[model samples]
Target: MSTPTVVLVHGAFADASSFRALIPELLADGIPVVAPAVPNRSLNGDAAYIASVVRQIEGDVVLVGHSYGGAVITVAGVEDNVRALVYLAGYALQEGESLGELQGGFPDSALATALVQTTYPLPDGSTGTDVSVDPTKVHDVFAQDVDPEITKVLAVSQRPLAAAAFGEPASAAAWKTKPSWGVVSSSDNTINPDVERHGYQRAGAKIVEIDSSHLVMLSHPKESADVVREAIRATDR
Candidate 1:
């Protein structure tokens, strides 16, 4: 089989640019990659968008998702052409599982305390809550290992996730059928590392532990990219 185009999905409080450093490494090896901006609105809603992206691709696809992006691919990867999944400190929620349910089972991380919610206008004339890491706490709780200069920018510029997404159950769990790989950021102060471990273990994903913060791609791009490449190689049949 031909080398599959790698589709990257970023999680909450992040956008496609989060993969900035990693993309070059993959492209350097002649790898075709696409990192799409997710809406950070709702789980199923985001999944549908990503699924459409995958269906339009020319060849096979390896879906790589980080953080909440993991949950997005968990549903989007149900597309026929997605052959593998690479999870980067991502939520590998099961079908019928919600992020709140999975994370609530484990002890709270610094992120729980660091998050701040604000209201946004809704189409129906009601207000909805958007969740984001407190700008002052983002660097410490979300990406301590990342460069302060970068984290400072990320703190204020981070995308806010719709709070509703935390309760929405995933409609599909792609890792159940697709070959999957995972990276656990042992130093993560956002989602508890144990949550990452349990999610991957339940999905039967090949797993590795990286001693980095939630933003593993920034602090350990080579290692994170290595795991992604492994999934690509294993599924390129």
Candidate 2:
């Protein structure tokens, strides 16, 4: 069979470039990759958007979601061409569950206190709240393993997730049907690592625990790439 496309879906507070380090490794290994910018609007909308992207691809695809992206692929991976899923410190949410509902079951992490919420205007003249890590605490709350200088840039360029997204229920969970793998960022500050472990366990995904921050693909790209490869080998049938 032909090689499957590896579609990297990034979570809130990040964009496609979040996979910069891991992208190179996948490319060097002759793996085709596509890291798309996810609109952190709502769970249903983001999943529909990702599913559309997958539908446009020509061959089998492997979805790799980071953080919120994990939740995206959980809904999108049901696409017929999607062969597998790899969650890199991502949320493998269950059907009808909201991010807030899942996270609420676990104790709040540093992110709860570090969050900086602000309002943004909508086309209808209404406003909605966006949540991001306080820029001053971005390093400790997001990815402390990354360089301070990088975190400085991360602070300014980071994308904020729509607060409504958290409470919005997930319409579908592809992990329920697809072959899946999960990585736990054991040292994550933004999300309680237990949350990651619990979600993966529920999904029955092969789990890997890595000592790193929320940005596992950035700090542990080699190990990250290894798991992606393993997922491909096991499911690229």
- For residues 120-197, write the lDDT of model 1, one tens digit per residue: 999999999999989999889988988899998998888999999999999999998999999999999998999999
- lDDT for position 4 in model 1: 88
TM-score of 1: 0.99
Per-residue accuracy of model 2 over 1-237 as CA lDDT, tens digit each: 568999999999988988989999999989999988999998889999999999999999999999999999998999999999999998999999999999999999998998888999999999999988889998988999998988888889988899999998888889888989999999999889999999999999999999999999998999999999999889856
lDDT of 1 at 73: 97
- For model 1, the superposed segments whose C-alpha errors exceed 4 Å read none
Error of 2 at 204 (Å): 0.4
Indicate the worst ten consecutive residues by lDDT in candidate 2.
Answer: 228-237
